[model samples]
Target: MFDSRHIQTFAEVVRTGSYAATARDLGYTQPAISQQMKALERAAGTPLFVRAGRGLRLTDAGQVLARHATGILSTIATAHGQLKAITRLESGRVRVCAFPAANATLLPATVARVAASHPGIRVELLEEEPPDSLRALREGRCDLALAFSAGHGGDAAEADGDSDEGLVEMPLLDDPLMVLLPADHALAGSSRAELGELEQERWIAGCRHCRGHFVAACAEAGFAPDIAFATDDNLAVQELVAAGAGIALVPGMTLPLLRHTGLVARPLAPAVGRRVSAFVLEGHETAPVTALLLRTLSEAAADMERAASGFPRSEA
Candidate 1:
């Protein structure tokens, strides 16, 4: 309940000991300085100055306030300086929450980039699916989040399905959904496969939040998927498929982390891509470390997208 401006004026007047001189130093008129002193005294509930012979002298309360004012102003200046350093990327931390696929692919690229380019910045990562990540972001537990939803590189509203009500969304990856199969499977030799063609096959579902979309896709193709296995682990899904347990439909973004030689990923014939995007609380999009991480993710996704252009399948 103390006004910083009034404190500053009081401190300046204390130092100068002359109303006219304090006004001249601070670029205010003499009467303005006099008014500020009166207002400051009223707020403090005590007389601060009195005439002693021909000069102004501080009352006991004035001396106490003057001592505290110096410390308050110093703390304020230090806070401003640290904020400026963050703006320059000299020191800061960005808290991130993202799904497993993004953690494996995009998150690492951002971490390495920040380490190499701005050593002062720290990236703290948490693994969660889209729903939990959005909840964490909305609650301010995380500064930024990476999520994927059913879409084909569409606009934010379309990709988000209008569910994200009050966050800033940035589209990162337009990764086509692909089916993973054993290398020797009959459809493995095909350039593209249709969901209806694999309707009778046992299915291994991918990420938890994305399972609903996959089920809907299968139903739209006129058959309900016989999901024999479910897991959020991309590698496990690939391993199950490679062992001929079941085929899995996965986002192309995850294919980069796969290393099993027995599996092949192919594009769906109708071509619907899973949309990966970044989200931040509305006003935090421009925060220095967060903005840097987003840019790094965008660039890394662009690289993966370009590689996928060489083949319709995500060939790792």
Candidate 2:
């Protein structure tokens, strides 16, 4: 039987990318970690890692083993929790990563609520873009990831099957695009504005995906928008609009999060909204705590929608 110690050593080496780093982290002598890796290779009857300069690279065989090892170790840790405790509220950790807008809006409330309800569960929140969050979730660096995509209204990348291999995505909410203008703009008091009315106005552009949303929404309305400034930060976009640099089509949820004195938000008459979803690795679904968190987050999103509807109408 392969030793647990050897498996742990291999995992540490793979994570740190160096035997010396692994030794420092694990507080073992460097040679001891190396010997454990050798033992692992011998048991498997194949090379798991290849020497690369002063570090090591996982051989194809090693990559496969590392993947399984990550799952196995996580399972073992969870099993221990299951045997020792009934409620995950007592002690555990949930790693969450999402894009900035989510971090600014839904995430803080969700995390704060979770932390308050389950003081024992450590909630580690990270601000990461979709690509990085997806990568982190697949590699076991995060327990859950919040993701967004521009659906029919924009040019969305074809969904890659491998992009969700080990994870199951749950649809959360659809956020429609809303136009943000200077509070004194002629159309700010209107319930909704048609895309064509703003065609000639300079635009404060969103990120690549959101830019697709604005550009496509306008194209559908028979005019191509003139984006004068492109920025990833929604707050910055609102600031630009307040400064009278231009206008922008931002997500509905962003109205509450982006605080700007001179900006007013109004939905487009024919709305375009992006779909947002939460994903958790497949095996984690069985854990009661993970399930609870998912349920709570979904509920929070529903509340956010209601809050969006109640926002005070701004006037020009």
Q: How many backbone clashes does every candidate have? A: 0, 0
Let me know the TM-score candidate 1 reaches against the reference structure: 0.84
Q: Candidate 1: lDDT over CA atoms?
A: 0.83
* Model 2 C-alpha lDDT per residue in residues 1-316, reported as the tens digit of each score: 6777788788889999999999999999999988998899999999998889988889999999998898878887888786566464677778888878888888888878877887777778887766567777887888888878775442121233244666778778888888888988999879888888987899988766567656767887789888789999776787788889998888777777766787778887777688778888888876767777798789889888888778764632
lDDT of each: 0.83, 0.79
RMSD of each: 3.5, 14.0
* Candidate 2 C-alpha RMSD relative to the actual structure: 14.0
Worst 10-residue lDDT window for candidate 2 reads: 153-162
- By summed lDDT, which 10 consecutive residues of candidate 1 come out lowest? 151-160
Those runs of model 2 whose alpha carbons end farther than 4 Å from true positions after fitting are: 1-83, 153-165
lDDT of 1 by residue, 162-232 (tens): 46778888988787888898888898889989988998899998665677788878877899999999998
